[model samples]
Target: MDGSCDDVGGERTALEDVGVLLADQGLSDAFFLERGLVKYGDAEAGNLVVVQVDEDGREHELVTGAGEAWLELRDAAQAEGVLLEMVSAYRSVERQAEIVRGKFLRGLGVDEIFAVSAAPGFSEHHTGRAVDISTPGYGVLEEEFEESAAFGWLEENAGRYGFTMTYGKGNAYGYLYEPWHWVWG
Candidate 1:
């Protein structure tokens, strides 16, 4: 998070805003570099489409290409008796900051939080291509998802739909092995 933060509509303004937010959260300007993290630009609002509406009425969205690919992947999995559910998709930088702030309020340090969550403007979710997924009978966002039939199906077939697991065991980014996270291009 060194130089600038980018949103579809604005770069300099978004950079300033994200910088202030990170400062408020006590993050250093070199946070991303220190963690070997990549900064992601926000998706264009017009390019996003609702991919799923959660039980709590929250809309999980992705950029059109990824959203369409996700739907196709889910349908293909269902046809094979593997159900995939969207846990999270296309998070905003603001929402990411709130998540980080919540972790801080809960007494977690930035190091602990970064192990599981990306710094606000650096999350892949901000790009509208990443998704957190789960299946029936598994806890959402849990590592146990790696043991599910859905995970097996994804490992075998998600690539055909242009999705790949982003965070794996011992990932270079230093995040925990997040078997539930994937990104579509």
Candidate 2:
């Protein structure tokens, strides 16, 4: 299949194409590109964002929730000498749209941009379960998170917290590789 062309055999929408972009960026697992999978806010109200400090003393964020599992994960990280901080949590679809537009101005083409930029209803950020982690001094964590220690740590342990890398290795999705971003189901 051509990475730039739409998946004719699949029912994926343009929004999912954006998810492919995210996967290529390393924001999460590529599997997220699968069609019809619900993310963040479904009927469970379990979407949240959490922050953490890396060995470099830099702050980072991931999409998560304020549930007990999240707290437990935080506590575990703290016990291991990891400084976890809570950054922004639960973003609205409007916020996600703003991000999509900004990405376009940054030189992302229509296909490279999420379909949400054109239609807000398809945004993963709207689910509030997806987060744009903050890599202080690194601009948006989307592209550079891979080189950050905070993101690496999360990659190793986020699954234990019910959080997973929405775009990453072994994923067929084509988003760029982002070491800093993550999502909770």
Candidate 3:
């Protein structure tokens, strides 16, 4: 992901039609530049592998490298008596726009929406390397997950498996603290 102003949509296989994707949700090129956001190309659909199927039976997929790392990380955590589960992974640029649009329809302002959700093409989820994780006995995607043993375990051990928490208190990107969001390099 980089901050280049190169045409977001072209013959480039790595990038998406980000301009149209954002505009559909009422965002503009200025929004990205004003926030100093980095653009993340969505991973090729074929490059993803199913990592898990949640209680709701929705499949979670990640890029092959990330999928392998996630499995290893989960096993290691289980060995240490920590249960890790994936709540989200591998979102597309279209899905990101839908999320933003949904928030807007729910009465959130653009600033409010971006505080928790990245703009289309800016979310690491598009790269298939970022994940939202939770453990048993906690509400999914809630801030309370930060208080769980899983968060502590991840804080202490996730780096060994190549994952790092992306949004913390007062993060530079101005997003709310998301202790459960992590990305594998």
Better of 1 and 2 by lDDT: 1
lDDT of 2 by residue, 34-137 (tens): 64444433333343444545467654333344345556766777677654444444455444544653574366765566432322344444555554455344
RMSD of each: 6.2, 10.0, 7.1
Model 1, 25-128: lDDT tens digits are 66764867776777665643348899899788999999999999999999999998899999999988878877775665456766798899887778889989
**TM-score for all models, in order of appearance:** 0.84, 0.51, 0.82
Regions of model 3 farther than 4 Å from truth = 1-27, 43-46
Give the backbone clash total of model 2.
30
Give the per-residue lDDT of model 3 (tens digit) for 1-185: 23332444356332244444455556685677576767866544449999999788899999999999999999999999999999899999878866765565455766788888887778889989999999999988889999999999999999999999988888888788999999998
- lDDT of candidates 1 onward, in order: 0.82, 0.50, 0.81
User: What does candidate 1 score in Cα RMSD to the true structure?
Assistant: 6.2
Error of 1 at 143 (Å): 0.8
What is the Å distance of residue 156 in model 2 from its true position?
3.0
Q: Which candidate has the highest TM-score of all?
A: 1
Worst 10 residues of 3 by lDDT: 1-10
Candidate 3, 59: how far from true, in Å? 0.7
